[model samples]
Target: MSKVMKGLLLVLAIALIAVPASANLVATSFGFPVIVQSGTTSAFNQDTAFASDFETLDIDFPVFGDGFELGATAGVVAADGVALTGTANVLPFGPVNLAFPSISQTVEQTQEVTHTDFAQTNEQAEFAYPFVGVGPVALPGFGFGW
Candidate 1:
């Protein structure tokens, strides 16, 4: 074997040997929006009331800017009070789904959110941020928790 080939193999072996058993993604800048909304013109009448909320989840690495997720909440108090759930793949930078007055669909939905009687703001929006590096020295994860 050539001297260069032997050296390369040796380096690879040492790197592999030093790598941790557990591996995880490393994040750079981490952020997500916990959007809240209320008060519209009409929700089918005074008898019927509706409220919708939205939140986004993102994981960012140095190379990739943002990965996206959309979660929402909806409630209707017409003849009977009802709640619905749904979700969708959203744009990392913006809300992926939207509703417009099309005069076509009656029950319009953007996404679904878990029902929280009292919705909390985005406190841990940037949690689980991972740390970086290549082989022998890479931080695990950060943001809030590591």
Candidate 2:
């Protein structure tokens, strides 16, 4: 080949080697509503009811070294003369790197109507550091929530 052609080929080869492999990224969202009930009986002539609305969104980009996840739920439960309504959410932040070992954090919250006609709320957070080994070997590192 001519010198100019040879130089062009060499540059192309080096560029291909320098570029990183493509990584898969995903993003999606969905919502669902559900209702469940049990059959009534003569002895226990009361029916239980449950209804909920749930929504979730997931975005993953491990190659870029970041990800996000969110889920929320609002529901109601009633039996006999008692009814309770509640809402909950799961939110996460930080890197979601699957190829390399990394740490992630998550926060959760829940609010409910108690039997005493009072609304109560609870919050929690957690951190996890996972060890990603070769092939299929992986160790789920320690995590604590409070």
Best by TM-score: 2
CA lDDT, every model vs. true structure: 0.44, 0.46
Candidate 1 per-residue lDDT, tens place, 20-111, comes to 89868654443343445444342231233456655444432212324432322232334446554433222244544342221222343464
Q: What TM-score, to 2 decimals, does candidate 2 have?
A: 0.18
Error of 2 at 44 (Å): 40
Clash counts for all predictions:
5, 0
**Candidate 1 Cα deviation (angstroms), residue 10:** 0.3
List the candidate 1 regions with Cα displacement exceeding 4 Å.
23-146
Query: What TM-score against the true fold does each predicted structure earn?
Result: 0.16, 0.18
| Global Cα lDDT for candidate 2 | 0.46
Top lDDT hit: 2
